[model samples]
Target chain A: MAASMLKVAVGSRAYSSGIRDVLWKLGRLNHVAIAVPEMEKARSFYRDVLGAQVSEPVALAEHGVLTVFVELGNTKLELLEPLGPESPIRGFLQKHRDGGMHHICIEVDHLPDAIQQLRQRQIRTLSPEARIGAHGKPVIFLHPKDCGGVLVELEEA
Target chain B: MAASMLKVAVGSRAYSSGIRDVLWKLGRLNHVAIAVPEMEKARSFYRDVLGAQVSEPVALAEHGVLTVFVELGNTKLELLEPLGPESPIRGFLQKHRDGGMHHICIEVDHLPDAIQQLRQRQIRTLSPEARIGAHGKPVIFLHPKDCGGVLVELEEA
Candidate 1:
């Protein structure tokens, strides 16, 4: 939002060294997900302490998470807590006892096209097909190893 | 931006169980940072493959890291690479060979007031003082332990 306020740091626009990729355009970053082991403490920090608009905890049974949305004006932060024994983030919390920044979700105009193009580039996706995410949108996660070790979720927003 | 489109979501505003924290309001999220071990590959993945506008790497000797920015419409992702052997993120990269999510920066309207208030609440800051950050603004790093294991940078914007 304030990028224009800062001086131009030697042409910020990336000139792709390879063929211009125009398969599908990516939209804004939807949300940065944080796996919070201490969900109450995390929620209080963002809501009561930071004075941000925060949503109540919603149990996403299918996704195996109890999620809360913290609005940061421009975007949102999703605070996730393991809901069941087989919660996807359970292992992550076990490894990082205090919790941590999990996968980030970015919006895309055309999810199918984007997925196909990524696969063609040998970018491994966690799933072959997009699934309905907690936001009720078609979303697919990319393998962290293939994407430089950061889990990325592309949502059809 | 699309929060309204989602079902009411049980009235998404935090009512602050106690006194409202009006000391300082948090602005939009500034950037989400990722530490990159293989800088070239990480840059290409976001630029050539994701088709996102990324910035040229800028080395900040003081901060001990090389920074690249990926524009995500609403927000940005800062790609950080250790600048020297004693770089702050060096240990992080060593633990995570392929690199991983480093920190998330959030804009604060008033840095000093926010710092004072947080201190009173017993939330620890990595530094007692705010220093000029990569964006040339006063920023302070909050303790990850107190922040639910997320390294949060509060920048005065």
Candidate 2:
């Protein structure tokens, strides 16, 4: 299981640099994922209330969380809820004291190059390698400690 | 001056949808702005430490704040500092009790259409009209109270 996970992770990070290059070319913003304590309540606002198109919530078993994607033009609003006690979303909720903005994800063309650059700079990453994110995009997270407490995600579009 | 500012605001909102649509064509995840009490300290982390290409900090006279933009791939990490006693960042800090994620900006294709759709659904918004944001982007804010206390920013990329 661990080896399979590792393979998936390596494959995801491999596109880091490609993602960076694409972002440079697009010159536009992407999506932002915010952590919410209750997924249903979040959907009420972003989907039902705001009228943003909603995508089915996906369960990320490895992360112990469930995420709902809200489509807005080219970008997306991702609402995350912890599915288990040990999930990081639980700690984020306690620290934030309420639902708040979680992390900023930038769509890149190459995930591996971005990962390599980040590693060269000694930045800490949450994942040992990139993994497939929701919607089949490759993604990796930079640790908040290395990012001044703001979780940064790099995604391959 | 207030009248002029108001006029600019009106004109900006008018073009919001056009810009948003353009951004939508480009891609996902645009930028994430974080508010901090100290600008230089935040700069050290995102710029020198993280190796993100940094832009010179700029002060917005109207908003009474200083902002620094860090370029990472195609997205930006914006760090903000309250410029004066009346700056809103100070209030956000007081209410949140810590320096953390401030707002998540999601790119959209049409601001007016989205806003109208949101209004039709009775979602609360911070402004009835879109406002000129950093980099001359037209943006509107969805009230946190309406989104489970998570302030959501809708922007035209």
Which is the leading candidate under lDDT? Answer: 1
In model 2, which regions exceed 4 Å deviation? A1-30, A107-120, A127-132, A135-138, B1-30, B40-53, B71-75, B93-99, B106-122, B127-132, B135-140, B154-157
Binned by DockQ into CAPRI classes (incorrect, acceptable, medium, high), candidate 1 is acceptable
lDDT by residue for model 1 (B1-157), tens: 0112122333435433224546777899999999999788898888777877777778999999998888887989999999988899999998999889999999999999999988877789998799999998999999999889999999998
**Which ten-residue region of model 1 chain A has the weakest summed lDDT?**
A1-10
**Best-matching candidate per TM-score:** 1
lDDT of each: 0.85, 0.64
**Lowest summed lDDT over 10 consecutive residues: which window, candidate 2 chain B?**
B1-10
Write the residue-wise lDDT of candidate 1 on A36-131 in tens digits: 997788888787666676777889999999998888878999999999898999999999999999999999999999999889888999988999
List TM-score per model, in order: 0.90, 0.66
Tell me how many residue pairs clash in candidate 2: 24
Report the error of model 1 at residue B29, Å: 0.5
Candidate 1 collision pairs:
none
- Interface RMSD value for candidate 1, one decimal? 4.8
